[model samples]
Target: MEDLILKHVSLEHPANQQSHETEGLSSKHLVVRRGEPFRVTLFFQGRLFNPDRDSLVFRAQLGGLLVKFPATFSKPQSYSQWNAEIEPGKSVRSQSVTVTILAPAFSPIGLYELCLHILTQPRQYSYRIGEFVLLYNPWCPADSVYLQTEDLREEYVKSDVGFLYMGTSKNVIPRPWEFGQYEEGILEICLDLLKISPQHRRNWQKDYLCRSDPVYLSRVVCAMINCEDDRGILKGNWSGVFKNGVSPSEWSGSADILKLWAESKFSPVHYGQCWVFAAVMCTVMRVLGIPCRVVTNFNSAHDTNANLVIEEYYDGMGKKLHMSKDSIWNFHVWVECWMARRDLGSGFDGWQVLDPTPQERSGGIFCCGPSPVKGIRDRHLNLIYDVPFVYAEVNADVHTVIVQNGQVLSRSVDKERVGSVICTKSVGSALPQNVTSAYKNTKAVMPSNRSTDGSPRSRRSYANREEKHTLALSMSLDKTPIAGETISFTVTVTNKENSPKILKEHINAQAKEYNSSPLETFWEVHNLLRLAPYEVKTTVHHITHSEYDEMLLGDGLMNLAVVMQDTGSYERVLVTEEFNITNPLISISMTGNDYVVKNEKREARFLFRNPFHIPMSGVLTVMGAGLLHKKVHSNVSLQPGEIMEEKISFTPKAAGTKMLHANLVFKNRPMVIRGFTTVLVRAT
Candidate 1:
């Protein structure tokens, strides 16, 4: 044994990485997928190796955890444990030796140090061979994170560009997002997220050990995404004021946010909302080799109590009141990770919910899930990790109460309002794929016999229920309203009975937050509406910019309601419409080149028009990954009906699909306009 001389060691990083499909994870280390075998070779000037006389032990370490396993002399067969084997004939060779090492499917996914021990002649010798990274394998059948098809894995794990569904369910809008998992500095920061979490700070070895399970990893990532409990990634901001940090709307991709967090030494990135949090989490998951997708729930319920009931308060004139802590957001975004839930019994394996929004606490932490979607859909309250909470988020009943002072005037229970639509980006496309049926049964078969269809006829039918009163009332927006312009809407009243009826119409308007209740009323009008026998009448009213500009200044949410009371019968009917005044759009166009080339300068022009009766001034910020190195900003002023065009020049950094995002934030007013264009950069 003393005569044996060691010369060189080989980790076979390229072939191992290619076999593990980890060529994109990193370039500095040997990256391999867990549950697969990677070869390590030894080249030395030594006597013929003897397995019986010389004992070998291999140690793989993560943080403070060091696992030692004995090496066998034959080819490996079973993969039940962490084991290594020398090639069948290489163990008896004279010069070079090859050994295959297999990390179990459930091995923790992260960087690991490999060491070899040779025991002989009453002494043990050790050598530090190399380090490697292990990641979840969607292609491996034995892995819990495995997906069956290549198309889904491509869509969920490989696609760097995605669209987040927003706006009302009736009019779903797709917002482009750059996952940028493969971009420079993104994968490094993503791995750093795990190391920076509170669990890692407390006991890194324990944290790393649990990373073997996608369930545990998802839970940790969920908590780390919000900075509430731990000094994690994004600091959430739902309030309209963004004075000290960047607005959530200003962010178009995860690379910028993750890069900022890493560059700032893991300080929480300034601002993030639900969609931002979800999008950033998607990027991190994809970078770590997990299949994940962003999902949106329209009319999503936020039930403070676990009673499955969301109580909403409104005034007689139909202005919503902030009396209850529970809320119904127009839309709430979260992520669904694909994995097999072995902890839960059968039927729980599949897409599991993992929301990063700091909405509620689970087991005394701000993390919301790894909640089994199957458990939520099946009403399995006994399941762990806040199943009941997510169940209520999509299955709660809306209890609408109209109160006057301290008295309740009108009360109705709407079961179909919450979770009316659940959707995600379609595979290989920008269109939305409805997933409402996956969470719960279609409501058309429920007692309400209502459909989740966002068609105008269905909405009208849902809005106007035949009442016993004499007058039938309905309300609608005149056109898609925008801020900095007049707001106009129409209210119709029809006589249902044979006799003529005179009615008093009370029209009111109030501003509100996205999920919270409305604040004080900004405007109201009263009119005497008279209808002849079988006559229908429509009236239009306008509220100039000055009338509700203050309300639009924050969240751009407003509610219009009309209460009609018959003069003879004293019967009353109320109809209301909630709307959002969208900010003006900044149209972005490319120039100078027919196609974007890597390492070449390109220009993008931003065009914005002033549609108000007053002058406007704002700051424009533009950013792109693999397109621009950093954010670019400029200032502009525009008169009424004036169009402003600004050009920004930047050189492409890497070749791939990229997105150019432009945002115009009004300096003197509360408005943000957003636009994005996709660029396919050709490699030079």
Candidate 2:
């Protein structure tokens, strides 16, 4: 009895003889883009085999079916040919034999397995050599949809870093997170994602990439990441009502979420918010060779009724009334994918919005746009997909009405607040790029053909008329406030009349749900003030975290408004401000080690203090892209004035600058304290 073994294998270009070896084949996955030419060389040896009398057959299988190759077995080149060793008594022996595999340009994108069968006498021996993955070529003429600018290529196509901008427009802050799409585990998850089709099987056509379009593929991704129909991938719970007690923002990367989803086939991934959904979708898109960038819209409007207006009503006592179906989120995150809209034709090819947040439905499914950005800017609401819905997200008028006993007391309109800065991560950097102008009109320009009237004044004229008749009311708040702290703001009212006047002042603050209506009222204050002619009065109000927690709605984002009315003239004015009550920034120190080598395990200790007076209990999650896999310690309780310490053991799998994130969420409280540190991982 003798054994047959594969010595080595290599892929080479026939003309240039440029080769890639398959020595540690399983460890290294071969990659090639569509329309590329390459030849595979297989070297094998057998103990009792005669090369002159035995024949070998090579076969390539894709999606469990044999794929046809154009050519195989070129004339043996000197460097790869088999040399026979003439033995004294051994029957004609060959040390090694080489075979060449020629793949055509039309070979589709997929994992192709190569197998070799040796035939001698009545027995045939078979072995699986290796597998190669074919990807879509962005540089190819037929794949021009993936072609992007250098900046876009760096930010969306190549880089796995993402930025989530929270807070208002005046104080926009960026939170950096990593996506591990290039990781082997994440790549496997993405490949599996393509196969789990709930409603449709359009992700891969005939198990071939060339047969499908990018537009449809992107839509499928948006639907899959949300786990809308199928078990899906990410479970979304914006209300923080998760069975695991961990908020969506606690998770660090898409890889961990996908890994959890893969491990627990019965249970979907724990949690994901808008940014998480968008970030994970970016990973999936980029892994599939589609250019994608996560976008954050400040003061994003969610018009549930398809109307280009977000309306809010209030009572005379300054209590916010939930009368309208529309609402505005302090910030919302979505992804913009670059692709050619062959389905929609010319003038619509570019970055298309694809939101996987699962807020509303589009075309009966939970997937959102392929809606063209140009159409949104030009007010082409008649276009396909959810153009009207997205148009209002970036350019919508906010109208606030004060009513008492079903009578409209006063109404004011704000045209500049609904959607503020539309931002994305800058190319090759972590900074934000203001792409507001790309989504809507930045300069003073004529209204699009879809406008109610041809003139821009129609939008601003109503607001100006209300301002002239009502007293000047302005509301200002301290720069971004943190939870577990007192937030103070002043409301100033000016009486411009010549005669003395009596005014009624109403101040209201209420918690609001993301993309939904306002929730329970947190705090409210009503007062009567008398002002002399041309007199200005300023009143300050303070709110504590305990008071905010009492009426905390979804995520602790609040809508504060001040309504003032002139009792003498019966004129009214309203001023509103939107702010996010973020968790107090606790000091987090990472010690024990500053760096680690790739594939080496290291332990790091982290100390984070609880700034709140009351004891807190929640989950502490530590995660990183290539540095540390997700390690979470649940039911971590911290006493007042106590510093909680956690030790994390992680193995660095990839080299370069890696980020380690620690998120602490207090159960039943709308506070989520987060801290991160960058570590250098050298290649092993």
Which candidate tops lDDT? 1
Against the hidden true structure, what lDDT does model 1 obtain?
0.81
In terms of lDDT, the poorest run of 10 residues in model 2 is 16-25
Q: Where is model 1 poorest over a 10-residue stretch in terms of lDDT? A: 454-463
Q: Where does model 2 exceed 4 Å of error?
A: 1-31, 36-39, 44-67, 72-108, 113-130, 138-142, 145-154, 182-184, 199-211, 244-246, 443-467, 586-607, 629-637, 644-653, 682-684
The lDDT of each candidate is 0.81, 0.68
Question: 225 in model 1: Cα distance from truth in Å?
Answer: 1.9
- lDDT score at residue 389, model 2, on the 0-100 scale: 85
Models 1 onward score TM values of 0.88, 0.80
> Residue-wise lDDT of candidate 2 within 140-214, one digit each (tens)?
445634574556655676566566776656556567677777655666567677676553354344545442467
Which model scores highest in TM-score? Answer: 1
